[model samples]
Target: MSESDSPDDIGTSPDSLDLSPREPSARQRRQRRPWLAMIVLLLVVAAGGVVLTKFLTSAIDYYCNVDEIGAKEGCEAGRRLRIQGIVDVGSVTDNATATEFSMSFGGVSLPVVYEGEPGGIFKECIPVVVHGILRDGVFNGDRIEVKHSNEYEAENPDRIVGETDKGSECSQ
Candidate 1:
């Protein structure tokens, strides 16, 4: 048969073809369900956020100061807490199993017994955050996080560490 008589050769020109828009297939409709996809994504994200908040809250320990300890209930019942205070000078005693010291804030003092290794920053008058439980008028600290302020030299070379001297060369 001639090439023109073949079915494959039918309507080869652009004008002879049916070019109108066609309805989408089932597969295409399912793939393009934006509302369903968005709802699923939102549910997953909300569940993840709720789980993260619960985990973080359970892991955190609340912090308070020495002066607040007297007014805080459940302190002496061995409840785990984070207490911030300054180490009292000449109050540290190093022992075999533990290091005992007194930390004071606002004239309120509390004894602390730490059995863990105190870091190099542990010194008299240094601020620290102790994580442990309070019992029998003493805080049994299992962990210590030292809080050190930033060290910056003022413009004046002869003045105190952070003090500014008007006549010093730093003003220039």
Candidate 2:
């Protein structure tokens, strides 16, 4: 066939075709719109999830140093809370039924009461985190998580030295 005989061969050649100027059809545009909408929806959902997670975590987590708990208002009575402090000297009172202790962080001291058997590391001067609620004027603790400071004893090289054994010498 002659080079200019057919209209279908206007932008095409036998060896190479130049079909770069074609406009997209209506069906192609419609198909792309849904995909774009889906991407926007996914981004919105992810952002909402992040905000919800932050709100939930903040509502559940609570931390208060011993002094902060005492000086602040509305701290003496509340829901479950966490208090961090060092055990006061001669403040641990253990009996057959329960263990009562007091801790000092900064200038404040708060009493902690635990009903279960105290751990081996439960002693005066050790750092601890008490978990419970404050009812009336006292902290009614259900669980205590003791965290002893790192200490090394030269006399006892075989045994690990912990703050619980040191006995109430920690400074506020």
Candidates' C-alpha lDDT: 0.77, 0.73
Model 1 misses residue 112 by how many Å?
Answer: 0.4
| TM-scores for candidates 1 onward, in order | 0.54, 0.52
- For model 1, the superposed segments whose C-alpha errors exceed 4 Å read 1-61, 73-77, 150-172
Best by TM-score: 1
RMSD of each: 9.7, 8.9
Error of 2 at 71 (Å): 5.0
Task: State candidate 1's TM-score.
Answer: 0.54
- Tens-digit lDDT string for candidate 2 (66-114): 7776566544557567887887888778888888878887877777788
Residues 76-165, candidate 1, lDDT per residue (tens digit)? 345677888888867889988898998887778889999956986897777888888888889999998888878664576675644353
